[model samples]
Target: MKFKIEFSGHENIRSNHQKTIEITKESHLTPQGDCIVGVNANHACADLPQDLKEKLKNPDSKITFSIDVGEHNFTIEGKGHPDLILTHDEDIVIRKSDFVCPRTLAVKCDKASDLLPREMVSMLQDPKTKGTFTITVD
Candidate 1:
């Protein structure tokens, strides 16, 4: 199953969080929200397709996220846990740990915000930058 989200960059994006990466529907961000790489998201965690969400609740499912910003592309791989509720109204978060929450998309991710290329992070600091993220379960 698959789901997709479109979002844009924010001026305050730091992409410095060590354990997670996030995208949110909120229009603004503070430097403290270092995990948030994109804002003004078109779809939140709760907006994921039912089939996709269903797969996300299976502990044996592996998930892949394709991150695209301008011409740059990146991939993040993680596992879905049975604890996933996929009910957050405004955010989609991918974590490098086992922590589960309403906002969590996938846990034990192979990459966190801090692991993204600095050049890509720099480009994402511009509010004019747009991004597309696709999530797939296989």
Candidate 2:
């Protein structure tokens, strides 16, 4: 099977001062599994605000990132994990059931909308939230 992933929007909500990184779709991919594991390679270092840069750079600091991956609207939090481990980051993979089926046959992201703040009890409740983007499996 194969799936196409699309990232819509993301925000960093560690301190009261909220920092965000809006990314347009760079590319999409489909892996053999029902879901594919995607690691934000630059999640730890890039697209961060200057004020938060140093703290995020700390190897001991727990830095988590949220992204709307190709309609699978979900956030992956990095907890006690190094930003560079090529395999460890692959632990969480987004799969088909994560999204509303049939309606969203292909995944896509807005890059301008879709923001999930930390205060929210559920990331899935955000209004800017669009249902998980879908992909074809074959």
Candidate 3:
């Protein structure tokens, strides 16, 4: 599938930087049954506040990111997983929670149950839904 993640606004929560960045999705799904998407953080690292990046690396962080698919906006929040890592190529890890039923879909994210609505996850499970999606970071 082909998709783009748009990062706009200033670096930190507050800044006047007018830079906007777009990163393409490398692939989906991880070895441990998770949905993985990443972009080189360096592309917009200069605009981002240092603290936000630190928070992203912290397992206890409560930061939430949004993924917009057509009119539906699904959310993915931070999971305090020890394996979760945020570096130059920021990998957004979506894990399957206990709420998700067993499935054969390769597009499912393990951490997504708590982050995304069940119905949205169901829609994504459909192979027809693959192709283009957007991750908006503001």
Q: What is the C-alpha lDDT of each candidate?
A: 0.91, 0.27, 0.33
State the lDDT of candidate 2 residue by residue for 4-119, as single tens digits. 33332223211121222222222233222112222222322223243343343234544333444323343433222123221221122221221312111111222112234433
- For model 1, residues 54-130, the per-residue Cα lDDT tens digits are 89888889899988998898899999998998899999999999999999999999999998887888889999999
Which runs in model 2 stand beyond 4 Å of their true positions?
A: 1-6, 9-24, 32-45, 66-138
Using TM-score as the measure, the top candidate is 1
Residue-level lDDT of model 3, residues 1-138, one tens digit each, is: 122444221111111112111222233333233232222222322233445444433445444445554456655443333333333243333333312111111112223333444444455444344322332222
Of candidates 2 and 1, the better by lDDT: 1
Error in Å for residue 4 of model 3: 10
What is the descending TM-score order?
1, 3, 2
What C-alpha root-mean-square deviation, in Å, does candidate 2 show against the real structure? Answer: 16.0
Q: For every candidate structure, what is the RMSD over all alpha carbons to the true structure, in angstroms? A: 0.8, 16.0, 13.7
Query: What TM-score number comes out for model 1?
Result: 0.97
Error of 3 at 135 (Å): 8.9
**What is the Å distance of residue 56 in model 3 from its true position?**
2.1
- Candidate 1 has an lDDT of 0.91
